[model samples]
Target: MKTLLVDDHEIVRRGLKQLLLEAFPQAVFGEASRVPQARELIMQQEWQLVLLDINLPGGSGLDLLVEVRLLRPQAAVLMLSSYPEEEFAVRAFKLGAAGYLTKSSVADEMLAAVNKVLTGGKYVSVALAEKLAIALGNPQQQALHETLSSRELEVLRLVATGKTIKEIAAGFSLSEKTIATYRMRIAVKLGLSTNVELARYALQHHLVD
Candidate 1:
């Protein structure tokens, strides 16, 4: 199998590559530090699996996953992110990722996750599996953040982190008006009227670090 590893950190890329090489000695591997580089590599070669990070330079790994699904329908993508699994795993799965693993996971678990995806299976940590099951069993108990669309959730996270609309617009390369519109929509969806309320809600729900 061929694999592509995408991450901004060189040390992480190197470590993951070495781990993958040890786990699947015959598997050909490639690496990229940003979405554009990864896109170039994808256009030039076919890969059986892609190990992606949620945070990437220039673009999000979620966006890359969408593009990969469109460009290479058969390639399985396993997301590797520092974000909490409960916060992003379901979204990633909905976006066509085959598996989701957090950065804090052990090396053995990482190897097992890669192997599971390679063999046409999905992977989630045991704790995450239990949490997912519980959430499925009780719809009313679901987190409010889960009700938000991916983009709205991203906006909420940024707001919770104390980013102003202008700063967020600059960070996302969007217009301030556009970000303000999103903020209003998010407030409506979450029953919040001000940034203070939004920040409080986010903190109460542990939505931000």
Candidate 2:
């Protein structure tokens, strides 16, 4: 099977490779450290499975997930992230990711998720599953952050983390003015004024690290 791993950390990529090798010795792996590199690889090849990290150098893995769905629709993507945040997981699934997994998940869980996704099934952590259940059961109880678009939520997360416009722009490869506009839109939507307010909202909502 051809598997492509998109993560910025070499150690993470290596660890995933090592873990997967125990189960599938014949697996062929390709690795990419940045969004651009991952995009190029996706355009050039067909991967049976893709292990994609959420946090990348210039953008979130969600962006690449969209690209993969378009360029290699047959590829099953299992999203990897350090954050076990339910909001992120929800966005990922909505974007067509086959599975959402935290990096902290046990090897067995990871393997099971991989197996399920590769078999054309979807997987989610138990915690995420419970959260999703509650969310779907109580649609009217949706949190304010849920109203934000994926990009808006991403901007909010970065802003809540105290990232400056320049830094956020650099990470997104967007202009400072564009970042400023996002900030303004976020403030307007949230009805919040200062960074402190945004940070506090994020913390209260468990969006911030």
Top TM-score model:
2
Compared with the true structure, what per-residue lDDT tens digits does model 1 show for residues 70-108? 998788899998888887898899999999998888999
lDDT of each: 0.86, 0.89
Alpha-carbon runs more than 4 Å astray in model 1:
200-208
Q: What is the lDDT of candidate 2?
A: 0.89
The alpha-carbon lDDT assigned to residue 29 of candidate 2 equals 96
Candidate 2 lDDT, 96-172, residue by residue in tens = 99999988899999999999999999998889888889989989877777778777778888888889999999988
lDDT of 2 at 42: 94
Q: Give residue 103's error in model 2 in angstroms.
A: 1.2
